[model samples]
Each structure stands twice: as structure tokens, then as C-alpha cells.
Target: MKIALVGIGKIAVDQHIPAINDSPDWELAATVSRHGSVDGVDAFTDLGDMLDARPDIRVVSLCLPPVPRFAYAMQALAAGRHVMLEKPPGATLAECHALTAKAQADGLSLYATWHSRQADMVAAAKEWLTDKRLTRLHVTWKEDVRRWHPGQDWIWEPGGLGVFDPGINALSIVTDILPHPIHVTGATLKVPENRQTPIAVNLEFHHPQGAQVTADFDWRQEGDQIWMIEAETEAGTLTLTDGGATLKINGERSGTAAPLGGEYPRLYAQMAQLIADGGIDMDLRPMTLVADAYTLGRRETVAPFHD
Candidate 1:
């Protein structure tokens, strides 16, 4: 399968490019980026130009931020190419739905990947939670934004999803491992004093099965940051740490495993299988939760943040 990559940013380099290089079924046909180039690969600064030039490109992986993903995805799907989207899909629920519709109309595959769901421990957590009755959940994702984001000013922009940058990973894992769906009951966002978007968020989730989940995400933590989820259930208290790479049950270490490799590679494999099997995989449940959180969340201004 001939594939093109859009947005040659950090993630595109750290994950997408290497994944494409390693995939046997996928060939990196072209790339569109404003300020980067890939050796031996056709490169263009404009997505439209690349699409027009490489008519044989059957797949397009959009690594751009959420701002322009919808339009690019629409164009790619309309041109009869399967599209893969990075997390958060689009800035809003309406845009995501529109892309889904466009993909269906064009008979193309749309893969909205939640990389956290592809973590090694996620499936194990799912299996462990299957028969257990969850009573409470606590999630904490605190990271040093300056160290991770650096000069990426877009992260603090209005639609850039400040704290949700890492929070969404927790949400994805929670959504995947839970036995039943959960709804946002309440949320409070802490916006930086100088920014229109939030830098931290505390959310409460309510499930029909009497589960109460609380998530706290902050972009201000320093040193050894935390990305952990703890669940209290009838069977035992389960703890997932290191962004779902390690799991423990009732204070005892349970497992330690890393994902096979890059998430994009696994995603492409899944996409290839979908195409070969004459089917599509589109799950919007997680995106819906994110949209709902944004719509229902309350906002408060906090101290100013600086890069």
C-alpha cells in the first residue's frame, strides 16, 4: 500500500516515519511538511500538491494538529484514499462526524487512533476488569509541559487541548478497559491566567454501573512525572502505571510489558487487515467523551504559564 504522511512534526518523526519505514505492507510514497524533508521520499510543502502528484497513494496519515485535520482528511477521503488520524481526531465532534460520513460515502477506511489503547497493558487491564465490578477510579497524569512541548505554541492555543494532551490518553485507556460506558458528570478546568485554554483539568465520570471515576491532569508537574490510573473493584484494587506499561493488583506488582513497537505500525497493520477483509473500523466512543467533557466542563483562570 502506497502511503503519504502529512505534518512532519515531532510525532511524525518520532513515531509515524519510523513506523512506516518498518511496515512491510506500506511504502512511504510522499510527505507534506512545511519545514522538514525525508530522504529518498517525495516531499512537498503542500498537501494538495502531494495528493495531486501521487495519485497512487492509497493511504494518508495525518499527523497535523487537530486544527486542520478535518479538511485534510475530507480531501484525502474524497480522493479515494484511506485516512489515519492522530488522537483527538478533530477539534470538535461535528467535524469528526462529518469525516466519518465522508469516508463512508467514499468507501474508504478512516482510522482514528488512540495510541494509549495500543499499549501492552491495556488489553490485560481490559481482561482483568471484565468480571470485576468497579467502584472507584483515580487517574493522575502530570507532566512538565515545557520539557515535552518546548516551543510548540499551538498547544496553548484555543483549540489545542492544553492539559488534555496527556489527559486524553488516560481517557482512552479508561474508556477501553471499562466494562460499560461512562458519562462526564462534572468537570473543572484550570486555564492559565494568560491563555484562553486550560492547563489543568479535574474531571468526574459517572457510569451506569455505579462507578465513580475522577481524573486529574496537569501540565505543571516537574521531575519524575506521573501517569497512573487506580481502580477499586470487588475483585481487588488495580493500578496501572507508566502510561499503562505496568499494572499492579492490591499493592502487588502484576505485570510489566511494552507494546510490541510503534503504535502507527500496528494501526497500519489493522488498516491493511480491514481493507483485505472488506470492512472498516471506526470507533467514535472515545472522541464523543472528549467532546462531551469540553462542552460540559466549567472553566477557571489560574496563574500564567510561560514556555
Candidate 2:
């Protein structure tokens, strides 16, 4: 498959481009960007030029931010190109749903990818959780935005998702590993006095069988970074850390023959397999959870934040 990457931002450079180059199933055919370009790849100023120039690009993976993804994805789909969306597929669930429907009606492959959920250990954790009764679940996803995000101004803009940008990765993993579905019951968003979105969020969820889950997402942690999810079950404790790359069952590290395949590579392979199988696999549960959070959350103003 010939692939065109739509965004040349940090993630597109750091992850998606390399993944596409590494995948035997995909060729890094072209790119569309305003400020960045990959060395040896055909570059265009925007998607329109890329689409018009390289009609051989059968698939386009959008690495752009969520706010702009919907428009680009619609354009791609309209051009009879398969579409792959990054996490938080769209600014809202309704847009993602519309895209899914459009893809189905047109018989084009559409994938809303959660790269973190493709981690090597996530499947093992999900398997281990099967048939076990959970007592409680907890997610600790914290990091200093200054270190990770630096001075990116769009992150604070409307529909940028702020802390939820990274926090949604945890939600994606949780939605994948859990045996059953979860729905947001309550939420509280802590916003900086100067920002439009929250810098931290506290969310509560409940499983059908009455298992409780809580998530604390804060972007202000200045010390060690943390991204971990653990569940206490009647059988034992299951934990996934390092963005679900490492797994622990009952305090012992889980084993695997292939210890790791970088998340984006795995995601690309999954997309190829899904496309080959004539199936579209894009889960909206995680995105819907974020939407529900915005719907049900109460807001609290905090001290003005400064980068």
C-alpha cells in the first residue's frame, strides 16, 4: 500500500513516518505539511496539492491535531482514498461517526487508530483480566507539559483537548483492556485561570458488573513522569506501565517471545490486516468517554498557568 502522511508535526516525524517506512505493507509515498517535510519523501504544501499530484497514494494517515482532522479526512474519503485517523479521531464523536458512515457507504477502509492500545503487553493484560472479578481500577497519567509539549500554542486553543490530549491515551488503553465497557458517571475539570481547557481532570466510571474506575490526569507534574493503569482483581493485581509496553501480573513481570514492536509499526500492520480483511475497525468508546466527560464534568478555576 502506498501511504501519504498528512501532517509533518512532531509526532509525524518522530513516529508515523518511521513506522510507515518500516512497514513491509506500506510505502512512504508522500507528505503534506506547511512547515515540515521528510527527507526523501514527496512533499506538498497541503493535502489538496498532495492529492492532486500523487493519485497513487491509496491510503492517507492523518497525524494532524484532532481539530483539523475531520476536514482533511472528509477530503481524503471524498477522493476515494482510504483514511486512517490518529487518536481522538475527531474533535467530537459526531464527526467521527459521520466519517465512519461515509467510509462504509463508499466502501473505503477507515481506521481510527489508538497507537497505545497496540502495545505488546496490552493484549496480555486484557487476556489476564478475562474471567476475573475486579475490585477497583485506577489510572495515573501525569507529565509536565513544559517538557513534553514545550511551547505548542494550539494545545491551549479551543478543541485542542489540553491535558486530555495525552490523557486520552490512557482512556484508549483502558477501553481496550477491560473486559466490559465503561461509562462516565462524573467528572471534574481543573482549568488554569488563563486557559480555556482543563490542565487536570478527575473522572469516575463504573462497569456493568459494578467495578469502579477512577482516572487522574494532570499535566503539571514536574518530577518523574507517570503513565500507568492497574486493576485489583479477586485473583491478583494486573498492571500495565510504560504506555502499556510492560505488564505485571501479581507483581511479576509478564513474558513474551517478541518483547516489543514499536507501537506505530504495530498499528500500521494492524491497519493493513484490517484493510485486507475488508473490515473497518475504529472504536469510538474511548472518544465517547471524553465527550461524556465534557458533557458531565464540572469546572473549577485554578491559578493562572505559565509555561
lDDT of the candidates, in the order given: 0.86, 0.89
Tally clashing residue pairs in candidate 2. 0
Flag clash pairs in model 2: none
Worst 10 residues of 1 by lDDT: 255-264
Best by TM-score: 2
> What is the lDDT, from 0 to 100, of the residue 54 in candidate 2?
89
Residue-level lDDT of model 2, residues 263-302, one tens digit each, is 8898899889878987788798888898899999999999
Residue 264 lDDT (model 2): 88
Model 1 Cα lDDT, one tens digit per residue, 1-307: 8989999999888888888889898899899989987999999998888878889898898999998888998888888888888988888878988988887877788888888887778788899999999999999999999888889888889779888977888888998999888988888999988887789999988888888889999999989989999999988999998888888888888776766365567777887887776566667777676677788999898999988
The list of candidate 2 runs beyond 4 A from truth reads 256-261
Candidate 1: list runs displaced more than 4 Å.
259-261
TM-score of each: 0.96, 0.97
TM-score of 1: 0.96
Output the lDDT of residue 60, model 2: 93
Q: Against the true structure, candidate 2 has what lDDT?
A: 0.89
